[model samples]
Target: MAQRMYIVDDDKSIRVMIKNIIEDNDLGVIIGQANDGEIAYKQISSIYPDIVLIDLLLPSLDGIEIIKKVKNEINHDMIFIMISEVSSDNMITEAYEAGIEFFISKPINVLEVVTVIKRAIESQNLRNVLNQLKNTYSIDSRKNVTAPITNSSRRNTMKIYSELGITGESGCNDLANIIEIIVNERKTNNHFNKYNMKEIYLELNKRFYSENSIKTIKAIEQRIRRTVIVALNNIANIGIEDFSNYKFEKYSSVLFDFSDIRLEMDYIRGKSKQRGKINIKTFIEGTINLLKD
Candidate 1:
């Protein structure tokens, strides 16, 4: 079924333009529209839209206030895209705090709005799939009595890495472990650190207590580089087999930089001899963020 969306803007022309764009692009169907914030809240509560396009400044309650009231009192899982002319940090921050997933600036561009909403919807769908996979694994574990049920998150993480054909590589587990540690550290600090190879290696070295830090870090780096290359090659090979393979379509550029993936793809198709360079920090950080989500 097409996802239902609601538009809440004080301006009728803006609302109609948004509705027309959504319809033209076939992004989703807009189920309702409200000119006032309070009316939007009531209508949203009644319809339970999958997505909401709301103006930051509304007639009665304002966008942030309406979001806060709805999220706190009525619905919690609805996706919100804030439409605003005001770019004040305070207002943006407040909207984000109140659960806006994206922003559509004034003089809305059709492409940007569609792209942002589609990306958000895709993320939500991916999360739902992961949850279903986890639940299925849980059910199967309960039925079978042999091996103990491993951590589902870890299992899922490993499954993703395994799909890229890196499970047997020397540093794969080490990378996974360090990613877990980094994610935990982020949780503790309530913020994500902008990671560097040296800093990450130093942290891992502390945990593992290697005899020679420099040598061990170098070895670790090499191993991870090889493993990431393997993953890139795997995606490229999949792309070669079927250019529109869903796995390749979704992961080709996301797991690595697009330029790097393009290089790997060229190599796979026998167009280039230059090996793709994997950004180790980016790979690990992206994997950590992916698994955490």
Candidate 2:
């Protein structure tokens, strides 16, 4: 589906650069733009974007607050990526707690941004797949089964989520929440399947845009593997001796190409020339010290 995205930043150049890449690469649709925190929050709540690219510091509100408040009030399973100069460990943790998918430090790298956004999208989809299985299976396990005794779409969805490594992401939880929202929407709207990616873009645009601003149509594209790297990095923290573990094989090989998880994996872990089956033990005792300052 053509994903929907919004950019909230003060710098016109940065906005222009992002617009060019998104449009050139054809990542998704841009519904609106906001210059600061307050404006962003207001616009986002009303528009309900799939992903939000926000700067850390803004005129009215800071980026952190934007994430905090949006997550708090709207309570949607939206993806929030922080692009800022802030490097405090506390701030990073806070963003995670507030439900941000990833943090990109300033002097925003276009290539990096592209990569991150793409991973986020794939991760988000996986999140949806995972949640649907939880609902269908959890219910069938307890309440249904004898109620209908029909097809097994839920099983298929769960397989996709596991195979996709959507279960491995911090944002996986948020994605579940989003899937719930989509499911509810589907119940009331009979035309849900009729709305393909392009239709999804239009729906987002109509919700976010009340006026016709040319700048609102700016394009945004992703590198196709940025967030996957972040996901792998997070998984690495879970544990890995070399790269032979199930997690390594899963992220590096199985789930690698969804959004091209390779970019994010390469970015998170140092580059490895060897591709096929890895040789390291998956359980390395607290090797994170080497990764520390």
Q: In model 2, which runs have C-alpha deviations exceeding 4 angstroms?
A: 135-293
* Candidate 1: residue pairs that collide: none
Lowest lDDT 10-residue stretch of candidate 2: 281-290
- All candidates' TM-scores? 0.46, 0.49
| lDDT value, residue 247 of candidate 1 | 74
Q: Write the per-residue lDDT of candidate 1 for residues 1-293, one digit (tens) a residue.
A: 35668999999999999999899989886767899988889877654566899999888789998888767665335688999899789879888998998999989898888898898678556654553343222222334433323455567678888777666544566567566667778879954387677777777666553344566666555545645766776787787789898878766666888777778778656688564667777777667667756
Query: Model 1, stretches more than 4 Å misplaced?
Result: 1-151
Cα lDDT tens digits, model 2, 151-174, are 333233334345445454333332
- Cα lDDT computed for each candidate against the true fold: 0.72, 0.54
